[model samples]
Target: MTVALMWEARAVAGRGGELLAWARARELPRVPLRRETFRAPQDRVLVITWWDAPYDADLPELPEPDPELVTRAVHRWRFEAVDGD
Candidate 1:
């Protein structure tokens, strides 16, 4: 089985690039991670990370959180490839 974990967070001003670099560096070895950006008219920014990993299998733990760059907002999910396709 495969699962997709979606994370939505708000990034600090002038820090999104730094955060992205950090995330790309830390993403798991075999997992697939992708990001998308959205800009609000008021200048706020939203970043979403879509991470895919095998389901019902142990996943590598993530590193310690960075306190300065990202603030986690919502985490919602739907199961995929539930029977391992």
Candidate 2:
């Protein structure tokens, strides 16, 4: 099975770049099959990591950024592929 973990965060008023850089510099204990990072208008950063594991398997995920860097706690979601192909 394959699972994708989504981590999203909204930086403080003017710390978007720093937050983005911080996210980019983080290293997971193990690398995933695929990973991607994205940014949005409201200084929001999103990182998705794909892994080959069961839905409930233990997987590496990005951690929360420094409290001073974000407006609130980070948001995370886990998803598994549902296609029948």
Candidates in order: C-alpha RMSD to true structure: 5.2, 1.3
lDDT of 1 by residue, 4-76 (tens): 5544444566676665555546656554555554554322344444446556545443343466665553334
Deviation in Å, model 1, residue 29 alpha carbon = 5.5
Using Cα atoms with residue i matched to residue i, what is each candidate's TM-score against the true structure? Answer: 0.48, 0.95
Q: Write the per-residue lDDT of candidate 2 for residues 14-55, one digit (tens) a residue.
A: 788988999999999999999999988789999999898999
What is the Cα-based lDDT of residue 23 in candidate 2? 94
Clashes (backbone N, CA, C under 3 Å), per candidate, total 0, 0
Where model 1 places Cα greater than 4 Å from the true spot, the runs are 27-54, 73-78, 82-85
Q: Please give the RMSD of candidate 1 to the true structure.
A: 5.2
TM-score of 1: 0.48
- Score candidate 2 by TM-score against the native: 0.95
